[model samples]
Target chain A: MAKYLSKLSKSTRSNLYTVTAILAAYIIFTVLIATGNMSNLLQGLLIQIFYYAILAISLNLTVGILGELSLGHAGFMCIGAFTSAFFSKCTVDIITITWIRFTIALIIGAISAAIFGAFIGFVVLRLRGDYLAIVTLAFGEIIKNVINVLYIGIDQSGFKFSVKDSVSLNLGEGGQAIMNGPQGIFGTPNDTNLTICVFLLILFYIIISNLVNSRSGRAIMAIRDNRIAAESIGINITKFKLLAFTISAAMAGVAGTLFSHNITILDSKKFGYNQSIMILVFVVLGGIGNIRGSIIAAAILTLLPEYLRFLENYRMLIYAVVLIIIMIINWNPTCIAWRKKYSIRNLLSAINKKKEA
Target chain B: MSFISYLIKGISLGSVYAIIALGYTMVYGIAKMLNFAHGDVIMVGGYILFTVMTSLGQSPILAVLASIVFCTLLGITIERIAYKPLRKASSLAVLITAIGVSYLLQNLALIIYGTETKFVTSVIPIPTIKLAGGNLAIPGQTLVTIPVCIVIMVSLTVFIRKSKTGRGMIAVSEDKGAAVLMGVNINKTIAITFAIGSALAAVASVLMFSSYPSLTPTSGAMPGIKAFVAAVFGGIGSIPGAMIGGILLGIIEILGRAYISSQLADAIVFLILILVLLIKPAGILGRKMNEKV
Candidate 1:
């Protein structure tokens, strides 16, 4: 086993370690829950942590790997949440098998978000940097606001859609409003569980990590490092940018599906600029381009606020302070210098030399 | 007549946006970073005015002046503490720090003031102007805001074009390295830009609260983002651009609310912004910048 592990490349080994770590964590938590060793509060937070970590990973693809600042990630999540919730609600009676129904809903959500992502990418990719960021932000707000005013119902005549209020939906006898405008969708099956979320999380991680290691990933990174240089080398800038963005959007959609399924009701308000910023916070704090760091940061930051519930009014205050402090430590020149000089790799090398001496 | 009234209201709202956009444009011009906390500064300014007028029983003039002074100092302090250390960092790092500062300001406000919305009394004492035999009565806020916006815009333009420090700002924005080579104090110029921006935020706060009559910790957020959109619309880093963008956005917002579904007005405004960005990426007044190899 040791000889086989030694033959694998460093990247593959690291990937193996990540997958094992995640699976181990899932197993340990499942055992804890099964044996009644975990508290209800902690158990409730488990799925949310997985989804937020997924969000961080998705955002990291755009911000960290692709080198684009997306301020409207929540918009794509909104599309996923609403679309998935709408699907689940409409098909609950039709599709009795719980797992099958949820699998379809997840696929629907991801595909819809991917479609929107491609459309937005096509338009916004023409611009660069800050302009692209603002356009995305605008797109996000438009999605949320438009979703807020969208009223959908199903009757004998088929699906009825209205931008007006629910009263205008004018449902027939035995008909029901699936989406009641600003009130949002109610009774979305609480189908999300730790098992599915963990599976999806692993799947997403694999996809992103594999993408990053592939030739396309190198092209994307080249575009990020220097767009002009990448273009000079004959890389299809639009195709790669759209590919990364669409995949990122689709992953965020899956996360949104997880979120919607975890809750009884899904509102567009949950997917807004603030949420986008929060996810961005996760990606930024996690160390840009460091997949593992994003996961760790998302997990810790998501759990921190819940744990700090003891602080009451001061919870957010402390959270903000911690965010600022972490940023400084991570990015400050002096701190970076300090970290470099005493890094674990250097320490390990030094210990080897000392033993040889 | 109602249409005229709505148009006036839109103009007034646009004026408020113009002021806030000025702050954003100026900071972006000199410092080349989005001051996300600029909106929160407006909130702070509103709170200051509320405390001064209601809590401390001060006059409106005094309240406005006090808010401006406090916000200016706040801006300078924020720049010195949070931003100064990040001058040479990546733009994303700076943006995240700005967001952290924004969160810090918001949470701090939450701690100190709680979540209650403070209804502030209008500081501008101008009475409603009854035009055309009371058929179109312009509110006092509009009467004051439009003139105030015009005066501020004109004077600010002059300041940038004529004043020594203002020219220093232009130099810094034009070329940071060249500015330094010419012995321009980059730090001082950036700090002053922040100060001016924050001071404009305070004025915007006064005008905004007077018209809207409500203040919350997050009240500044939407407007701040809108003003940012406005800044980008007019062409980021251009003073005149910020003004036009703000007014245009404000008019569109108000008109969209009045004519279209009020609920989807924000959507319409944003949609228009997206459409405009598609056609002209740099914005109406923004100069076209070419990437150099």
Candidate 2:
């Protein structure tokens, strides 16, 4: 078995490994779903894992690769969710006529978010490091507050208009009311299926992985390593940064669409400052610049609390402790250096030297 | 109350922001880090005071002092554990670390305090004082906040300008390498800066809680970001500039809410930031530093 594994080409081996992993995951999910005893709690947890994984990977494009700290990625997500929600609301037969309207909503959401990302990038991309982070943070907060106040629902008396209108839409009786003020938009269509979400996620993962391995990704890495040397080599920092930001925003929009449709409830609070920080946490905890690490981290973080259900009220505390431990381990240079110093190659060479002696 | 009364209110609120902004500016000036966790530290201080005030049943002044001490220790510890190690790393790394620490702190608070809003009773008696024009009422809390802010600001200015340690801080902010060559203790100075800055944030927290009296885990997020904006608006490294910028921002926000649509108030502040950046990227009081090629 070992000889056969070693004989396989690197790409073939990796592809086989990925296929096996996916099959295993699918089998496990199917078993869990089929089991009558498992609660909706597990199902909800799995969905959240998939959702946050998309968000973390999207954010990692800018933060981990481009080496820019953006506090406004959530704003892009907000734009995407709201855009898709708006369209889904307008069309009644959303689930059946999915192909055309879904594509349009997704495109529109991506384009709008990308446009906003580009505009913000042009303005604040000049500032690097901490300055850029603060500006972006403020930008995110401003976007959230603006969305909060902008009335986007149909009113009663058959009047559908914005908050600027004189007559307000009275979402009568039931919770099926129009986007309530500050309460957030409700009754969005839950058209997101697991298959579609998984397919898109895998597609994004491949694209991002490829991009990070390409020449442009190398240029971004170079800039991240040493700005002066990269600039001296004639790399256009601003252009590349803007590209990363726009792409990241586009991906975030996709995630937003998935999120809005999956939950069927959209609120301003869902895309607030905390959500932005949460994405950042996932990226960092998963090992920055490591896409697989981010994916694994997102899945684990989303599922860990669910698994530790007995902790109950102390769940967050346990999560915090685990995070602190992980951070300490990651940040400790001595441990990393030691591992590098005493690798299998070193052990093999040392054994050979002793045998020769 | 007259417009002047409104002006006073603005100034008072701005004074609090200025105090908070000073912490941001000074730390950034020296470390060149955004300290995303700084505002959360302020929130932690407020929570500390709330705990002390509620548990010990102590007087307001004593509770405030205890909270400052608690926050000062927290600030120093955070610097040592999270930031000090990343000092040599890229500025972005430090910022990420700051964010992580912030999340850690906020979640810790959430775990400890739960997500409920804690109400704080006023420490100082509410005093209604008449002013010129129609009758302007001033809360005793506001009076205390203003004087305390002035005293701290004045003392900070003096410390930075006059004392040797303060001069060492200035030198370090100006040039870390050169300061080290000149026999400055870089770590000590940095730690001192964090202590002072955290203490100022503690003061801001106490004042804010005194006036508003409600505290929650996420409370620090907005004020922290706004204070950072104030720091930027007034030229990040300049103290007096932060003071002016904070007051100006406060007035703009309040007046914008009163006159214009309440919905557009936040937008207006952001527009101001954009306009300021376009017009004067260095900020109102900030001197443009030439980038080294």
Q: Which model scores highest in lDDT?
A: 1
- Per-residue alpha-carbon lDDT of candidate 1 for residues B186-283, written as tens digits (9 for 90 to 100): 99999999999999999999999998988888889999999999999999999999999999999999999999989999999989998888899999
Predicted structure 1, TM vs. truth: 0.98
Question: In candidate 2, what are the lDDT values of residues B17-128, reduced to their tens digit?
Answer: 8889989999998888888889998889888888888966878788889889988999999999877866766565566677767777887888889899998766667675
Which regions of candidate 1 deviate over 4 angstroms? A342-357
Chain B TM-score, all predictions listed: 0.98, 0.95
RMSD of 1: 1.5
Roughly what TM-score does model 2 have, to 2 decimal places? 0.88
TM-score of chain A of each: 0.96, 0.84
DockQ for every prediction shown: 0.78, 0.41
Task: List pairs with backbone clashes in candidate 1.
Answer: none
CA lDDT of B33 in candidate 2? 84
- Residue-level lDDT of model 2, residues A1-357, one tens digit each, is 889998987745664575466557756876878886558887766667776788898889988998888777788998888877777776645456876667677777778788888888889888766557667777777778777765655433442445553235444433133555466677776677666666666777777877877888888888888888899999998888888888888888888888888775687768877788778878888878877777788888888877777887667657765765566556656645776779899889999999999
Candidate 1 lDDT, A1-357, residue by residue in tens? 999999999988998899899999999999999999999999999998999999999999999999999999999999999899999999899999999999999999999999999999999998888888899999999999999999999999999989987778889999899998888999999999999988988888889999999999999999999999999999999999999999999998989998999988788998889999999989888889988888988899889999999999889888887877777777779888999999999999999999999
Question: The CA-based lDDT of model 1 is what?
Answer: 0.93
